[model samples]
Target chain A: MEERKAIVEIKNVNKIFGENHVVHDLDLTIYKGEFLTMLGPSGCGKTTILRMIGGFEEPTGGQILVEGERVEDKEPFERNVNTVFQSYALFPHMNIWNNVAYGLKMKKVKKEEISRQVAEMLQLVRLNGFEKRYPSQLSGGQKQRVAIARALINRPKVLLLDEPLGALDLKLRKEMQLELKNLQKKLGITFVYVTHDQEEALTMSDRIAVMNQGYLDQLDTPERVYEKPATKFVADFIGESNIFEATISHMTGDTASIGLEVGNALCLLEKGVSYSLSEMVYACVRPEKVLFSAGEAEGFNIKGVVKEQIYVGNIIKSNIIIANGQMVILSRLDIDEVPKVGEAVNIYWNPDDVVLMKSRGYQIHHVIENASLGGD
Target chain B: MKRSYRARNKTIPLLTTVSPVAIWLILLVAAPLLYVLFLSFLSTDGYNVVFLFTLDNYKNLFNPTYLEIYANSFLIAFFTTAICILVGYPFAYHMARAGKRKKTVMMVMLMVPFWTNSLIRLNGWKTLLGKTGFVNTFLQNLGIIREPVEILYTRGAVLLGMVYILIPYMILPLFASIDKLDHSFLEASNDLGANKVKTFLHVTLPLTFAGIFSGSIMIFIPSLGYFFVSDIMGGGKSQLIGNLIETQFKAGNNWPFGASLSMMLIFLILIMVTVYKKSGGDMEDLGVM
Candidate 1:
């Protein structure tokens, strides 16, 4: 394995706007040539953290080091990064050619060199013939491409993107996500992308930093963040999961019998982590791990009546109302048999599938909001 | 006659919608201008305006004395526009970026003076800059000067008066334009490796050029005809086109000659307006409303 080099390091960063603490004591180190995404809901300080790195924002308290030099006191232009703003922010008064050429022109580059590099960048963004048109004359996607070209022409060490595809329609957004990912790989440049879209972060990031409530919840590969979230917020923020708030009724070696409102369930305890009797904990289980059966299954501890079933693309999602009237979702492959609503069903999962985590004192409303936002 | 019928149909709607403004313009604006044009080509017979066509009044415009007045008028207009831009751009720029509360207070500060009659305001300047005025008295009491500075009733005084009255016109449009500029553009420019000065030059100035053009047109044209300003401030020492035309009508008793001078001023303004439109200036950018 090659040694991972840290390109930008943020240590104990804090940002406050008026009285609201947008980011609190955030510590993140971005490696060179890796696509890192700060993923969270809006107002979760993801963009603030990215802005602090790009020098657009001054951290209230912290030191940000870019390539081993402190950059908090530097202006954005003096930093070694460029940003592709969400609005595109192409110079409205210049043609596409001049817009792409602006960075080199500002640096007083030679005319021929600027032209060559601008032409190459435009070609790279696949906007080859849009040189003469103003930004007003281009479509949303073309304007987006022009913005990327303009930023990339400077050849900075890192690129900061603040939801660059957020304004595009769904189809264009998907296409651009792939294009931007490929462009980053081809250029071998580090990208610090900020987005509230969890699916986008999952699809595009080499590592995802799940953030909420001004805290860095977890940073890991998308698979790990989705499967083994460090905090309850990361579990809920990622793809849909049913979280069980339960009290530890009994404990054994590497297993615990937790008493949930619905019923008692056997769950896995993290190795070396201790849990006493009646300690409150959150148990997260992916929907697909919970099975819905017409008849009582073996080792079935949770039972509920079928509330509703939805067909989502290739998967069938069933909501099972437990004995406590709490709806626990069960996602499965569409096997042509959805238990009728109001019918009884047995819901169960393997004990190891439940990942027990500490409760962060979040209420049920926050989980529901994140689930609905994920649906969007 | 189908085309004629179509035209009539269009006219019926236009008549209902636009006729009031059209009639107002033609009757009040065009009629007087046409009368002036008629008088400019006519002869005055012993205080009686005659309907005889003559170019004598217009040819008199080429006289060296009148030409010197035109040159002086140009110089005053140029200086007034230049000074207003130099002073107003920074104020407008700051106001545009200021917080809403501060911006509101500053906006009130800028507009409160103009709410009063401009003539009265210029008269206030007269008292302020007079020989025994507050400024002179302050300086004399401070012992900074043994004699009062001759600031009042000079060309500089009239120029100052013009700028004071017209700076709001400059600042309003420039403020609107600068405020309309997306703040993200500055961030983008800085992100693209341009410093503040470069960003301002390449982005801010180019985007707000329409405001400058509209403001210049507003200040330059009015400074030429603000006859009362020069009268009160310049002490009638140097002749301006406004004073010349005023003398022709009041003391010289040559309405035809005065009409000719007004027509020439109108011609100069027309050229200016055409240039403004060509450069993409709009009435909305002028912030007149």
Candidate 2:
């Protein structure tokens, strides 16, 4: 497929703070009207990428193109982008109307036009009748909305949001996440959002870029990034997964048979070719895909004792200790069919449900098991 | 019965925390202000004390000669405060924004001048600005002037002395205010399309107004009553309200009139403070850390 024309293109950007390289050789293309989120853990340089795109920080190397023009040397005000900071950073001295009108006023817009736009923005954020109220008078969610309104009222080519809903409660954050996604779609504005919350990224982004340790692991549609992660880091960061150590036994077409310590398991290689027979590999499968049995009767199954059972409202998470003793598999069962702790059960999963990747130096099967079993 | 009785009975601590602070306030602030107020209303004639309630001292404060001195003092202090702010703001901002080592060095530099006695500093300035002082010598040596310029015993010298003495007081508070500013707010403003100048005008200036006002008040009120700088640096040729008040009390033997002038200065300060408070300004919101 042809590459999408980028409204904002960041090419080989690098940022070094003293001896620490915060963002290294980063490259990304933000499509027009696409809601893209850079998701990562703390200190992974997600916010730095967003700030660089907004022209807040000058990259140590490479170039940034906004609307097909190089803007590396442009000041933040000179660039046609605005940011909604995590703290909202609303001017406490100004009222809601003045706060929303700040950007337009800076552009020397006509007074009437500024008022009209500010009012329209207030309505957009559902903050009507709050024009006279100071930021201190508003609630946390209202402040966040006002921040969004303030950023959007500028009508920049791209809007950058750095964990804009991080300070709000869970319910409000989820609500604002959806509202922000809808607002972006309705306005048809390019949004480059930064967040450490994977669920937030998955829920709102048209495309999610999974980052780890200042490196882009994968950038793809939310479904693809979740279901078919391009790297082991992406798979582990996005959601809960049960990864097993396996050796590639055979390969035919898209199907590969992997030999595990418990038994021989089959995995579907969706889009990788750097593999050979008898090569050590890691298999990733979602916990929901793992099936538990009342009795032992399966073509390819691993027998394990249920070490712990956690009832998590909609789902029952069970930690099963495999025969290897060191390895543990996590299985998610429906809350209606809960399993008893210390009960022996056979864990099985379909071949297509497994994702195979070339194992790095260390395996994470024991780590996941230890976490599930509440091990230190 | 024992449990209910115990629950119903409670005893306050033997030594409440506020007792010491209350005693200190009474001894230092309240008592002195009360005595000054009492003295302002009392009347005296020559060497004899006439304990009579009279409005003569208050009336004498409105006389043209005394009023001119009052206005001169106000103008001088106001100008000194303005200059202090102009010089101190950038200095404080630089100090606040500097790195740890630079900030420490600048803070020490700012405070070092204050360690010297004000009288000594004023005398030093007087010597520097005198006819045969270092400045005139240097200027004469460079052929910039054929004769020694008379800068001492002038209003400019007095103003300069006041500003130099009061600059550290202004810079310290303003530095505290500027230092506590959220850097992200500036970045956010810049991202929102405000230029450097606009950001400074709209965000930085207004946010630090409380500190500026505080520093101004501190510098202005004290400079109004200061006589040593004007007397020493200005060579006794320039007479400010402080000199007038001092002459009335010590030299002119008019204690009642001096007490009245002091009361009037207090009233002016009160009015200024009330104006500041009525303007809906919050000192805490000035970003004072």
TM-score versus the correct structure, for each prediction? 0.90, 0.91
Best by TM-score: 2
Best prediction by lDDT: 1
For every model in order, what is the iRMS?
A: 0.8, 0.9
Pairs with backbone N, CA or C atoms under 3 Å apart (clashes), candidate 1: none
lDDT of 1: 0.89
Model 1 agreement with the true structure over B10-99: per-residue lDDT tens digits? 989988899899899999999999999998999998687888999999899998878788899999999999999999999999999999
lDDT of each: 0.89, 0.84
Candidate 2 clashing pairs, residues 3+ apart or interchain: B153-B234
Across A1-376, the per-residue lDDT of candidate 2 in tens digits comes to 6666689989999999999899889999899889999999999999988888888888999999999999989998788888999899999889999999999888899999998999899999899999999999999999999999998888888999999888889999889888988899899999999999999999999999888888998999999998888778888888888778888888888788778888766778766477766777878888878777876544566788888877777677888888887345465547356558988877777878887777763335345545766545
Tens digits of lDDT, candidate 2, B81-171: 9999999999999999999999999988987789989898888887788999999999999999999988888888989999999888789
DockQ: which candidate is best? 2
